[model samples]
Target: MHYRRFGKTNLWLSVFSLGTMRCLAGESNAEENIQHAIANGINHLETARSYGKSEPYLGNILKKLPLPREQLTITTKLPPTPDSQVMDQWIDESLERLQLDYLDCLAIHGINTWEHLTWVESPRGCMQAIQDALAEGRIRHLGFSTHAPLEVILAAIQTNLFEFINLHYYYVFQRHAPAVALANQKDMGVFIISPADKGGRLYTPPAKLVELCYPFSPLELNYRFLLSDRRITTLSVGPANPQELDAPLAVADQDGSLTPQEIEVFSRLETQAETALGTDRCSQCYQCLPCPEMINIPEVLRLRNLAVAYDMTDYGTYRYGMFENAGHWFAGVKGNRCTSCGDCLPRCPEQLDIPGLLADTHQRLNGSPRRRLWG
Candidate 1:
């Protein structure tokens, strides 16, 4: 597998790191996948307290293996439970679940707002817990994961408290490019999540997108596009199974990559997709705030974008199922939760008609019959 310098850490990390979201679902088969990944040179394993049962399953698998903990890098996150005591409890629980004495890296999960930053960075905040864990040798490094506005990310980086960062970045979602660049400048490790959602759709893309990315598989084009930037320390790939893992590993070995001409074509394709969708690309800034129903507007917009951009109605359907069946659904806003207050309109830099676009998105994905304020 291709390896890149992990910023100033001087560690060479595989471009294809294993993500544990799906692995948690297959607890019965997680060992096999973990073994497969290790055998294939995937030295980095990423999980989180928020991903159900992932840490516990991984802990069980590691306990049975003979591999030394030092040979592997383990990354996980603490959920924003808000209470510092709860954060401490979560960290200890994570360590117990992972069967490790200390975490190589631990992040404050999902910092999407300034409020989140304040809570984590305050004296009585989660950062205190993180610092205590570091002092006690329970965590080697502290960091954070975010899908916030670029300014928020920039502000976090300025604190210089983190050793690493996880963020959403890819060819299609270039919002975090500036943050990635800043991480590079600071010698901090940068991890990217969900290239497929950010970059590829399982189904065929529009002909124009395909034409724009000639000589590269949609996956390869997207991966290569991100790898072109040196700031990216690692790219996390969520493979449903072992077979799906091969493509990304192969991408690491490519020699002659997409040329400038291909890049130009890809750019045109992105523009065309935006034009055709007719919705302002959500930068996931969450500037449109206080959804009456607490629906995560950016996440919904992302799912909608995936549905249209990748043409994977089934995938979109599954994502929609998460909203319908999951208990923690829409901690931010429910689907169709907008009251059409239009308060977020003036705040949006893109000037998108939030309510109108959401209505169209709801109709396109869930059909008109299911339409309502909180459906």
Candidate 2:
């Protein structure tokens, strides 16, 4: 139940916020679980306009609960639309669905490309429309959620228009940490999304990682790792059912400090990882980037690490399949595209055999060529 200054908002948000992305699942005690989480000091409830039925479901639960309006912090992301009128309609609909007078925060959901940024800046765009809502007292703060490239994300943060940001940054995907630090420097709130599930699916963590993070579940380690950094404001925990809240609730009660023993464990884990994955293992340093094949080298290699080191070959294969479909959001090839011209090898500080790793990664994770997500 510990709270921290949510950047420039100055709101003392609980380190863990209740995310409403998966609340509509058929769980009998879903509402009661939400009430319990609220009772345990989770004041922030975050949702998006496009998260299926989550907004309405949470609205019904909040209406039935005894909590007052002033005691709760509600946030919802307005789906990005090029048409200003449609954006207006979506914002109004979100307000109606949430049954709230004013949103504590409203974000432009999935601002994932430079084109999206351009659309937001266009005359008939959501930015002005949302700001109009802001001036009318419909929303208290303006921000955005993005799954864009690191450079694109940095550009958005540099704009200085957002009061906060919701982005992905976890133990396995620390590449976004520099952008997060920039947000901190700009005095903007940073809400990390889906740390457990998207953060390497730690909820059902591989046995090796579990042993590596001794004394803490992989989930706890991931949660604590993000919280240990002072720059991060809150982590969005999207619980699908009542049972899903147990470990997260326990994590929330923790002090969020990494003890000496934990640090030693992490160090040992890194060493073990080097030993297991060998010299060819990708460190995801991005130094060997700018691949000519439009391939996301680090991404494909990390998938290989999942298979070889973490023993998550099935998950790795699934994620590798996602590359062809991820498109702009995660632009990459499935490692087999490497022509082996020795382009990336000389640039690598670790002298990694990039082409060989790519071949192995493709072989390990490209089984049956699963269809892309949203294809």
Candidate 3:
């Protein structure tokens, strides 16, 4: 597997780390998959308190493995809270469940809002407890994982407190590009979260995308795309079984730079999108904003772009269904909430019919509310 320097942390990490959110006890081959990932040189194993039973399940597997503790890097996360004592308890609980004396990294999980950022920054809040842990040799490095918007993400990086960041940034969703750049400038490790599943659900990609990414599956292309940027430290591969690890394993040895032919495939994909979308294509300039109902017009339109251009109806529907139900993690109203006030029409450079397209997005993508993969 290819290894890269994880920014200011000074640790060399595998380009693909094993994310343990899907490592539940119910999956019969979970242990085997973990073993397979380790055997293939994935030393970093990441889990969170919200991922039910993952910590203990991984702990059991680790206990049975022949490798010594120092050979592996372990990370876990907990939500930020105002109370330091409570934060300390949560950290203790995670460590106890993992049966580990110390963690290589600890992330303040799900800082998806300004309030969460405050909780971490507040004096005598979670940061104090985390600092105490660091001093006590319980945690070697501190970081945060977020599903927040770009503004929030940039603000978090500006704090200069974190050594790493786990976030969503992949081929299909590049909205957080600035955040990645800022993190790199800050000398922070940038770990991408859920590239295959949340990265446009490439595991069951549309045929058009498969064809566009010739000589590689859509999954490999997405991983390669993220790896192309040296700022990105790792991509989380949340495989549910041993077989699910094969796709990432195939691409692990690669240097992540796109060849000339691969660049042509990306150009082709863009051309197809432009051809299909025409003037309706959203540049994601975000000029149209401050929706009365808090609808994320750009995101909705991006989903529409996927559904219309790439035949990603399943991915569009799945994400659209999470609009309101996902709380801070998604933080938006459905496209149907557009008031048609025409306020955004004047702000858009493309002068697209913002409300009409939003209504159409609602028609095409809206479905039953779906919760996030983990709490």
Candidate 4:
């Protein structure tokens, strides 16, 4: 696999890291899946204490695999909650579960708010456990993973206590670019989470998206687009089954730089997307933000685009239903919370009937099963 200098850590990290977020804890095939990933040159395995059964499952798998421990880098995280003692116990449990003595990195998991950030950074809080781990050589480096607002995420990276930051940034959601740029400026590693699944459901992509992402599959398009950005260090994949590893492995082995034809194709894809999404859709210009009820209007509207433009109604509905209980993770309330005050209407450059569209969004996408996945 092609490797990159992972920022200040100075590790030649493979661009595609194996993520076990979706690994069925204790499944028999888990070992084979991991072995396949390793054979394909995915040298990094990122999981979390919270990822059910993944830690212990991987631990058992590693014992049977012939790969040397030194050739692999394992990372796991602790959620910043309860108290530092709980955090310490979780770490100990994680090591026990992984069958490993020391971790390459220990991330303060789900730093999704300023309060969570404080918990990680404060002396008497989670940092105490981390400091103890560092001193004991239980973890080589400390970092954080977040789904906070760009402002809060940037603030977290600016703290400089982290050597790496795992966050989401993909072709569909470029909102975290500034945070990544800040990480690059600070020489911090940027681990992009879930490029295929969360990055617009490319695995089961709509025909329109498949067509627009011509010459390359939608999955490749998404991967190459993110890899083209110099600031990104690694893209994560969660492969429970063997086939899931193939696309990521292929992408990893290739020279990441996009060719001139691919670059031109990228431009055409944007034009094609706009055409497919239609002229009257929410442009996502951000002018319609700052909703009175703090609703994530643009995101809900993007779901609408998925339904209407890409004919991905099932996908759109699944995403919309997730906001019902995702808490701060999905952030602001869905479009159903729109107060119809026309506050965002005047700001919208598209002159969209914001209230009407909000109503339509809920009617269309919130009636189905809510599918939620972790990165």
Best by lDDT: 3
Q: Better model by lDDT, 2 or 3?
A: 3
lDDT-best of 1 and 3:
3
| All candidates: TM-score | 0.78, 0.92, 0.98, 0.93
* Ranking of candidates on lDDT, top first: 3, 4, 2, 1
Best by TM-score: 3
Off by over 4 Å in 4: 277-279, 285-287, 369-375
lDDT of 3 by residue, 240-309 (tens): 7878889988888876578887788888889989999999988888889878789999999999999999
Enumerate clash totals for all models, in the order shown.
6, 0, 0, 0
lDDT of 1 by residue, 1-375 (tens): 777777665667887789887774477677777888888888889888878788899988888777887878888987655578988998998998898999988887777677877887788888778888989999887778886767888989888988788888876567677898888888898888777753545334555445555666667777777776667878887666777677777777652456787577687766756865665666567777656566667667766775666564544554554554443322343357678877778878888877876776666666312211111
Cα lDDT tens digits, model 2, 10-36, are 777888888876776543455766887
Which prediction has more favorable TM-score, 1 or 4?
4
**Candidate 3's error at 43, in angstroms?**
0.5
Alpha-carbon runs more than 4 Å astray in model 3: 25-28
- Which residue pairs clash in candidate 2? none
RMSD of 4: 2.0
lDDT of 4 by residue, 1-375 (tens): 888877888777889988887778456777777888888888888889877888999888888878788788899988886478878888899999999999988888889988888877777787888889899999988889888878789888888889999998887777788898899999999899888877877888888777767788989888888887778889999876989888877777665578897888778866766777675577777788788798889888888876776676766876787785677667777787888988888899888888888899888887654544543
Q: On a 0 to 100 scale, what is the lDDT of residue 205 in model 3?
A: 93
Q: How close to the true structure is residue 210 of candidate 4, measured as C-alpha lDDT?
A: 76
User: Which model is ahead, 1 or 3, in terms of TM-score?
Assistant: 3
